[model samples]
Target: MTGVVGALVEAWDELRIHRLRVLLALIGVAVAVAAITAVTAAVDMLSQAMREQNERDSGRSVTLQVNAWPATAEAASTDTEAIAAQYDLALERYGIEYSSRTLYSPVPVRFPDGTRGVDMQAVDPDLGVINRIVPVQGRWFVDQDVDAFAPMLVVNEAFMQSLGLSDLSTHPTVLIGDTDPVRATIIGVTAQRWTGEMPSAFWLYDQFERWWHVDPQMGQPAPTLAVWVPTDQADALSERLARDVQLAAPGWQVDVYDNRMNGMSGLDGATRWIGLGFGVFALLLGGLGLVNISLVTVRYRIREIGIRRSFGATSARIFFGVMLESVVATLVAGFVGVAIAVAGLKAVPFDRLFGSALQDTPPFPVSAALVGLGAALAV
Candidate 1:
């Protein structure tokens, strides 16, 4: 170990003496390493953003969607509350941690101008976990919101704008329903799905059922139960949930299927490969330039090498002494580059870059730094 330390010290000393000759090359190497590391981290964040966006649409990985509806007109009025109960029981039986029952209906809201019908979603608090629903301002629903005197709402940006509200700072309230408009407070605002999406809001399932009357023509949409489970258990759970739900709600059409985003692994893989390819190409160019500089430096140092040989230095010592200079220089460069990359990434506004706040924002991947360092060492 001492011998190795001495050799490393000697190499570092040589690098310091010849740094002026290799300064530009070392800078190139540092830039290349930073580029590679940054690209890797960027790809990881992009993939995470894509995954979060998909989760908002279809729930997270291994999400099982359960649908149950009456098969005949006579059974059309099948008790939805009972179905929800059965869904809860099933979830309890499996000890599922994240599950939510969601139903969609339109409710009339007394806006400042006039009463307007707005799209409404009745969902449980767990929906936030299963769907990665991050509110842009304020907070999502909690279990306590269920017992509040009035219903709580989480509306989109458009919904808040229609009510002439800038934010939830004042705890905005809007009257919902036409008969006896029940006052609902807007606790959160979510980003619009598009620039001009219609005003929509989410209400807790139980509160919505108790407060909002279902239209006869627009009868309550069938509730879809979303349960997030382990990927490996999805197929088995899907089959079991289908059988159990069917038996629980007799004469109803019951279906269970995986609703998590599909075919994204391929796209993520391609993106990573493409980004890595660019990084590697840059690294090669820098490596080639460094190699040329090193060759010229070695030619100029022939007398120094010969003097060491005359002083009884073995061939191995000379070889290692020469090689360690490049290694030590690159290791230093890699460290500086990685530090810069980490700092730059931390300062990035990821929410704006991805168009949404990432629920599980990936940390600076350790593997990315490893790759950068490994490439530097290879060069």
Candidate 2:
């Protein structure tokens, strides 16, 4: 330990004597390390945030969708009621929590200015756990009004803008399909949808039933049902549904997706390789700088080394002395690089790109710093 301390002291003395050279080498290493640290942190934050968002968007709480066909031929055999019961039972059997909803069609919406378009949706007030449509402005539909003739419309932000509607207080009137105009009130607006290649619009499902002339007891076919299952059990639940439920139409499809699966296929093996490539490049650059500094220091100290050798200094000691100098320089630069990276991350706005995950944590990677220090010593 004393020998190591002495070597470190000597290395520091030599570094102080050649302050300019040390600073230049330190700058190079700092740049490399800072770049690696910041990029890695940003990527890690982005990947995590995206995964969480995908899970939320996929409705991890409960499955959702409208049933197209009913189990019974009677007009009273609306599959909506039976399917909700099935979802409830399934959740109980698996010791999992769940919810469900029925979607209605597009209702004709008229703004205060009389501009109009079809706003599509239908929702179950009680069992909708996944994609719970919280009202931003007005209340969600109550059970008493489920069969009411009155239209209760929930317009999304984009739909509101397109129809020249400004505020929920405007008491916007909407026509359900070709039916008589029903005064639907604005209730809620959803947050912006997840980032993707597709464009998304927000709307209310409760008012869609009045406009589309759908009677829950009319026993009509539904277009689709969205279901949310626990990520771990998504595949198993989907398979069970497939084997147990007989579809009225042979071509009907059951699609299952979870949050983790979203954007996952796109990440691919190439992304890992790319990260490794950048890491390797950074290590190589840092190592090269250290090696160049070592060679120069050795060249300048040849006469000193020769004098020490004449005094019975071992080659092993000389080699260790040289390596120790390189390691000291690299470790110093590595720490500075870590500091710069942390400061720089604080100055940037990564929230829009990475969301709450980056906002909640520090961006430094301790392991990377250790690896960089080791690589510099090896070089």
Task: Give per-residue CA lDDT, model 1, range 1-379, as digits (tens).
Answer: 9878999999988877777866777898988999899999999999999888888888889899998878877667666666777888889999899988888887999988999988899999999988888888999999999999999999999988888888888889999999888999989998888866999999998898789767533665468898999998999899999998888777789988896448889889999999999999988887888899989988988999899999999889988988888998988888888888899899999998888778788989999999999999999
Q: What lDDT score belongs to each candidate, Candidate 1 first?
A: 0.87, 0.57
lDDT string for model 2 (29-141, tens) is: 77776666655655555555554454445654334333445435563343454444554555576664444444544444554565344536565554334544454455555
Measured with C-alpha atoms, the lDDT of residue 33 in candidate 1 is 92
Q: Model 1 residue 97 lDDT?
A: 95
Task: Give the lDDT of residue 132 in candidate 2.
Answer: 47
Candidate number achieving the greatest TM-score relative to the actual structure: 1
> Lowest lDDT 10-mer window, candidate 2?
195-204
Model 1 Cα displacement at 375 (Å)?
1.0
| Residue 19 CA displacement from its true place in model 2, Å | 2.9
**TM-score per candidate:** 0.92, 0.71
